[model samples]
Target chain A: MNHLLEVNNLEINFKTYGGEVKAVRDVSFHVDKGEVVAIVGESGSGKSVTVQSIMGLIPTPPGVIKGGSIKFQGKELLRASKREMRKVKGSKIGMIFQDPMTSLNPTMIVGKQIAEGLITHQKLSKQEAKKKAIEMIKQVGIPNPEERYNQFPHEFSGGMRQRVMIAIALACNPELLIADEPTTALDVTIQAQVLELMKKLQKDTQTAIILITHDLGVVAETAQRVMVMYGGIMVESATVFDLFENPKHPYTWGLLNSIPNLEGTEKKQLIPIEGSPPDLFSPPKGCPFAPRCKYAMDICLEEMPGDYQIDESHSARCWLNDSRAPKVEMPFTLEKEKTVTVGGESID
Target chain B: MTKNLVEVQSLKKYFKIKSDVTVKSVDDISFYIRKGETFGLVGESGSGKSTLGKTLVGIQAASDGDIIYNGQNIKQLNKEMKRNVNKEMQIIFQDPHASLNPRMRVGDIIAEGIDAYKLFSGKDRTNRIYELLERVGLSPQHAKRYPHEFSGGQRQRIGIARALAVEPKFIVADEPISALDVSIQAQVINLLEDLKVSEDLTYLFIAHDLGMVKHISDRIGVMYLGKMMELSNSDDMFTNPLHPYTQALLSAIPKTNPRDAKRERIVLAGDPPSPTNPPSGCRFRTRCPHAMEVCALQEPQWKEVEKEHWTACHLY
Candidate 1:
């Protein structure tokens, strides 16, 4: 079966006064028709840059896609013409941004904003688009759609505006939806509502979602597969269960140990990953995380490790995964006996 | 029994936007912080948790009621006594980017309190700044650099160092780690925990992140629309939440392990009512799943429902 989207050896750089900053280096991944994939990383890890390139949203003067291949449904997106890419953007692929306040047009009616996409892509009449826009509003769980149709973005609350964003993204029924830190700005209760809505919409529409977030809990709650990115590189990719049960990369281990577990009774001292993220302007030739990795060997500092397959569905980029390397025990584990049911029910 | 370091009585902070319209950001909330304990405040955006913290620290003057520090009401103190009390309480704001002055060197910024209090001068002042830098996990070389030169986590350390410069007994850390990256957030949290012990400090830690708050705080308070909904020990708050709103809030947190059974979330209906015109009687009645008729007719009395656990709800 062909992947709905395939990204291979993507290398992106930005031109600054200092030098060319290698924003993304040799990152590769794929998404099935209805799969949910999460890319987890800290700031400057190139998670946003990788997704922005897929949408052809990167500014050319500052951002340069040095080398890569982005194939959506077997068609090469990198070499596509401007007109062709434009046709594929909103009609075939949709995106929801981080900040709802700044992303929406303050002057225009939100209902019109949702209708505009339908008119442009589906070529519906004005009246037909307006009717469908109200329906779309209702579909996203916003009440009193008829009255809300005439309101501007400023009139809507943050959560309601985000509902508007979701309505706009799913208005065209795009096969792929990209959400970049969609709930990071909202409170936990509000975040829960938005995540639930996104999950329901994905199920009903059968849309493949590429969720970009720095939150590990959000990843566990919503995604099936997880990709851990560090210093512009894809460090690890595994099923969410495998990733959480037995994370392979040192960076992944660091991330797991850093956060305080909500279910755990004892207050453990957080073992933070010492030192800061690597400078992208002059990315290290070897492992970018080597300087911070506690288990770093001489080989890790001198050479970049290749992807080592742990199983058919799991892979990690670390020298320690090599057969020749010494076996080391992970400092943390989520024991089966310790796992407590959240709210005590299956999500499905 | 440990003494209460700070006690608040019927504290209220209201903002008047129109002739008749008033935004009661912190309305009739009473609580106390025990000596050397970290009190966590959790709430949604318009919940006014920040306002309550500000009022306790005297950053925002309370419209009514009293704030008692070590049994002496702050409002009753004279100018000199008030100034001394002010020095013992300081605040670390949420945004690291906006809090520090960009033009000032980090050393001078940290020495702002040191100079104001006349605690040290010349080399002793410089050494004090250096000692603070190392204490928060920064090097002495960082003193000469400006705030713009450091990362979010490093800048927060500078903020912490400045808070400790005056040798304050209490600090209001308002969402200090919210702006940082995940790994960076951990580093800052660990730093705060270390400082609380070495400095013998009491913290009013205000944040929306429940997990971090639960990890750092000895006691926890839940706020909604300028009202204190519940207050209890951190462990009891999580394990046996009594308030309907508290239960919903705890259920809303995403699970850390994917394999764990999905939480049967008690999803509240609609956004929180606007603070400008909150619902009559109980502020949370409009969205409460268990709202009763009395909840809308009369406001619930803030009472101790169980030993050491307090909540304001008619259900009790």
Candidate 2:
């Protein structure tokens, strides 16, 4: 597989008043060319930290990438010079954030924001950049791009503002687009529009995407492959089908079961993960999810489980996947033969 | 069948921006919540679901409508009667962090309703607060800490405790769990379910997530541009949607299972029209996939299309 981006032993921590808060620990994943890889995790799971490190957006004073190797297209990002990093920031790799309201500049016009990246990275003239910015805005499904170009960020609604953010990110035509919860702030209908727009744009541009989100529904919709993160560690990485169908990790099972599905009848009970996400400040030893894992074993608590390869492209960091460990059924059986009462004698 | 706890009739809440221009946030919508049942009001942002919730709780004044709580119209209640009605209705806001006071301790925040009604005092008050905290899955120790100390989910629990303090019969939870993490959302949802059953409470659950609403709600009302597009039992609405807007909204929800590729998504063309200048006829006509000339020319009548299923669409 032609890898567009790769990270090895990515360790990131924050220097707090009391102690060093380990945000991302020994995380490694690779995004293939023209592939959409989703990094799914709850808040404080280090999903955002790993992506921020990719864009060099992590503030060094508080956020220090203690140890890691980030290679974008075989070029080392951490070791890249200031001048080189600038060239790579917007032109090679672009990023869109969760809140478009704050991510966008209040003082500047929306069009000018997109133009700035084009002018800086593509070395386009001001007028040319503005023209291209309008095109980029229209490409992201924003209507009346020419008229919208003159408006400030406040003039646009939440979903339109997100379109502007996408316009800016894709303006320079970067090879990789890192969208950190792009549709999280938008409403469901608008979220659907944005996700569809992203899928269409990805197909048209063939831009590899790194989607960081906590919603499993979104993972199933957009991602081809998924990396499940927990307590600053990658618990599982597999194709979306394999991850959803034959999930190996207990945490993944919990996440999959936690979400209420639209296809089936509303289950009487949603099997929520018993405990909250592990605290990063004093993260537990061994498996970070051992406390919440239903099939947790003695080895799971005593020592960290290494990544056990399930197939050529699938792997999970769980003791349950070990050959020596006794076979354990996944905590939640997703497709139970649900008997539909309303539909009469039908099985799902 | 349960009796109606609260009934809203032609509730209209419009905000005047200038001399003549007004934003019709909630324009003449009617719905009723059964006792001990969850009535879900779902719509995107600016669809007036929150405004309707506020109107139901008596927080926002209605332009013209009747909110019948128990037996009396809350809008027409006397000062004493209004105070008594206020004791029975409560609301949980969307942003838990902003809804809570930073300076006040969790105990004082939860006890605000208790203190207002003069329910308890001193040792009894403290015990009540402690019980409320523990009921919401928080410890008694949590009462001493400020709102900033608790996590987003925990803060929401405190909000629930505060709402439960007054023993409110009808609670309007406006996107209460939307701000929490996915895992924490289930915990808060489960807590709310447990409390509802134990306290014999009725809920007007307002949210934008259809899937989550379907799980908790017995009946659902789909709103579009301040108008009720579809209202039906949760299962019937999801299984056999009548309104085009409801169908689009249901299809918009992202499916979780990748293998079940049978579901087709309906991506709406554009964002909803501004409430200030809503469409002439059907509010959803501009975005409706099956829009016709009549749809743009005349407003659709809200009619019962099937047994216990009501919809506002020209297609029906």
Q: Put down candidate 1 lDDT per residue, A116-140, tens digits, no spaces.
A: 9999999999999999999999999
Expressed as tens digits, the lDDT of each residue in B1-316 for candidate 1 is 9999999999999999999999999999999999999999999998999988888888889999999997889999998999889899999989999999999999999999999989999999999999999999999999999999999899999999999999999999999999998888888998899899999999999999999999999999999999999999999999999999999999988888897637578877789989999999999999999988999999999999999999999989
What's each prediction's TM-score?
0.98, 0.95
DockQ for the candidate 2 complex? 0.66
Highest-lDDT candidate? 1
Candidate DockQ values, in order, are 0.79, 0.66
Which residues of candidate 2, in runs, are more than 4 Å off?
Answer: A338-348, B261-263
Model 2 whole-model lDDT (C-alpha atoms): 0.88
After the best TM-score superposition of candidate 2, give how far the Cα of residue A160 lies from its true spot, in angstroms: 2.2
- Please tell me the interface RMSD, in Å, for model 2: 1.6
Q: Which stretch of 10 consecutive residues in model 2 chain B shows the poorest summed lDDT?
A: B256-265
TM-score for candidate 2 (chain B) = 0.98
The residue-by-residue lDDT of candidate 2 on A20-133, one tens digit each, is 999999998899889999999988999998999998888989988899899999999998888999999989899999999999999999989999999988889999999999
Question: B108-183 in candidate 2: lDDT tens per residue?
Answer: 9999999989999999999999999989988998888999988898889899999999988999999998988887
Q: What are the iRMS values of all candidates? A: 1.0, 1.6
lDDT of 1 at A134: 100
